[model samples]
Target: MSRALLTALLLFQILAAAATDTTSTRQPDLIKKGWNLGPIPVVAFDSDLGFEYGAVINFFNYGNGSTYPEYRHSIFMEASRYTKGSGQYRIIYDSKFVLEGIRIMADLQYLPTLAAEFYGFNGSESRYNKQWIRPGNKDYHSELFYKMNKDILRAGLDLQGHFENPKFGWIAGTSFQRYNVGPLKMNKLNAEPSPYDESDVLYNKYVKWGIIKEWEKRGGAHITLKGALIYDTRDNEPNPMRGTWADALIYYVSPNLNEKGKGHAKLALSIRKYFTIVPNDLSFAFRAMTQNTIAGTCPFYMLSQIVTVSPRRSFFEGLGGAYSLRGIMRNRVVADGFALANAEFRYKFWRLHLLRQNFYCAITAFGDVGLITQKTKLDLAKVPISEYNSYFSNTAQRPHYSVGIGGKLVMNQNFVISGDIGKALDNQDGNMGVYIGVNFLF
Candidate 1:
């Protein structure tokens, strides 16, 4: 089907659902729930990733509404690809009854990209050269020079157990991933017909200059034991208007790949809270996060990773892009560790309630900021001043900032389609970013 037809069908289905209500009260309609399903037509774009096309299905089981907003089980699945040869296949399952007091959750993902982002490291510690990546500039290299290709297969499973207080829990999970990384190939992304100049590729240049280690140039295995102390008391898990959710996970990465005794420990923490400004019509929400490699060496390719709590449009890494510093170039501020904060003012202008299904449209104004808390180890003294002047910035370290607005189409207080436009505070970070994706950032 055409994009317009698919979108129209989704809207029609939502409206048809809302028009069947027999009463003005939302309670009666929600009380008779057994299973609720929502279909999402994914239409979004990012400058780095290109346009995306796909769909998502959210399955929710309410089981008689004893807990109005909470579901007994939820399953989410999505498949999408960008026009530039990047794609993702994902499936997630969450359930409270899967194992006694423990909630069982699993995330399976397969992602492939022809043009993954690499903007150097450590926020402003190293300068970003716009001319190098921006084609047609006097100092321009190939358009694909700054990008690399990576294929990843990853799966994670967590068994969360709660004690007497439902608000507190202990989480233990394991993640296994294998990565294959290489220089981007112009032939694969429909560039076979017309090849570009490939004499001086960025990835090879870095390797030849000793800037990128030989071992990390080609990706390898990363397996970690994940443990956390989590506290959550959100009034609504999907679109919280009140309460707080705090979590911290420690990852003990086991020695893998060709390197032994290279295992390390990493710490990640996120705290989010929401407050009602005008009941359900208006509210404020915010999230603050930090991550660090406390000991041992982290792979060069993995240095940019940010803790993932939910899905977003592009890959999750370091501090940049939509989920972290909106409007900043994807992976622009990568480092060993970083800190970030995001705040939003949300307003609901429309509500649709019909029969057992309901929907709402919400708009939000937001601000985001992030910076490298720990620098990625790099020695500039050995490198010549000319190289630093050509490829790196000579500026003081500072935070990346952005301000933006977004709106969401929410189904039954659960499935959400969100779009936002953001502008970076400095031109070095990026001029702006436009994104469409799933769920809240936290």
Candidate 2:
């Protein structure tokens, strides 16, 4: 045999082996929905006849001059039936407890088969500490801690479903919620005049509903719409910290302080396009969105829930982690009404498998920007920490920007773990992007 012919044959053999190795050792976890396929007893074991359990722990601590030390800890448990049918029963429980800083919650979700894969009944009780953002020892903290405990109970149902065809597919879901919000009770005024010393005080109760839908295809186009109607009955402050003493300052100065949470309806829509503009080596994607609050009101302190309020606004609304803006704080953007557009570029390379399995890697680059169109009156003049509020003052005036790079580690075809580091261009702090999570950012 000629030397050239031998070399060609060797290359062909390597490619064949690579393909065969991947196909033979593959596991059934890659299959989305199916019964065991190989042997009877073994297939039963590989099928959905077993219970599944998962847990995640997340903790974040700020080092630079935060009011006080704060930490967030949450635990989640999921239990599901072992049968394969249109309906399976599942239950999920989550608890987030903030000992010193607020945000105490317990949530339970009951998912019945046949409804929708992602639909469920969820109920939760949340107790928010009176003064969440303050600088002091637990004992020295403001009177807000003594005034009242902000309590809320929520019950709701969710629906999610998908449809598929040869060239296109779509998914949709909606939810309905009712809330009972109340204040804490206490006996005497106490020698120290704690906010918790009050009694029989009630805030309000209300209902809310929302609908969300999105559709996409094997081609490269998609559309989405989401809207909500809410009757709010909570209080707000200009700062993240809420307490009776904090409120005293506002009531003493701006006697017109708005402590009531109003009701409102909000709607948003977006359309996006994806194109393999550079063959398999490169691709491009873009999205545009518009949002408005047609009716209702929001408490000043609850501002972050209604809009994206962050040091960076451009790409703050999407999933946070290694994906999205690679290197920014989670949900760091805030605004009442805004519009946004995003562009992403991706490149892939093969032939490199670190684990000798079906493992592979790739890199990506992306940018996102957004502008706020409207908002309610924003004032931090009377705030004790006016400087922190300044960063958000003209937030509606600037178009936020970020740039970053990311990488992926894919195992089999369905399991992927990725990370990305990004930095803000105009960032004075010049921090590095940090993210770690599963699956793609998109």
The lDDT for every candidate, in the order shown, is 0.75, 0.31
Model 2: per-residue lDDT, tens digit, 304-383? Answer: 22221110111122211123334433233334555656566655454233223344445667776655565544333433
* Model 1 TM-score, all chains together: 0.90
Root-mean-square deviation of each candidate, in angstroms? 3.5, 21.1
Error of 2 at 41 (Å): 29
Candidate 1: where is the Cα deviation over 4 Å? 1-29, 190-199, 308-315, 354-356, 380-384
Q: In terms of TM-score, which candidate is strongest? A: 1
TM-score of each: 0.90, 0.43
Regions of candidate 2 where Cα sits further than 4 Å from its true position: 1-172, 176-262, 278-281, 299-324, 351-359, 379-396, 411-413, 428-430
Could you tell me the lDDT of residue 80 within candidate 2? Answer: 33
How would you encode candidate 1's per-residue C-alpha lDDT over 1-442 as one tens digit per residue?
Answer: 2453356457757575656442233333345267788766667676567778887778888887786567788888889888878997899888886678878888899989888887677778666667655655666666665678888888888788877898998888888888888777767754321134663465666666777777778888888787888898888877899999898888787766566558778898889999999987799999998889999888777777666444222137647786787788888888888889999999877666654566677889999999788887765554666766766776777988999998787777777877777899988787888777767665
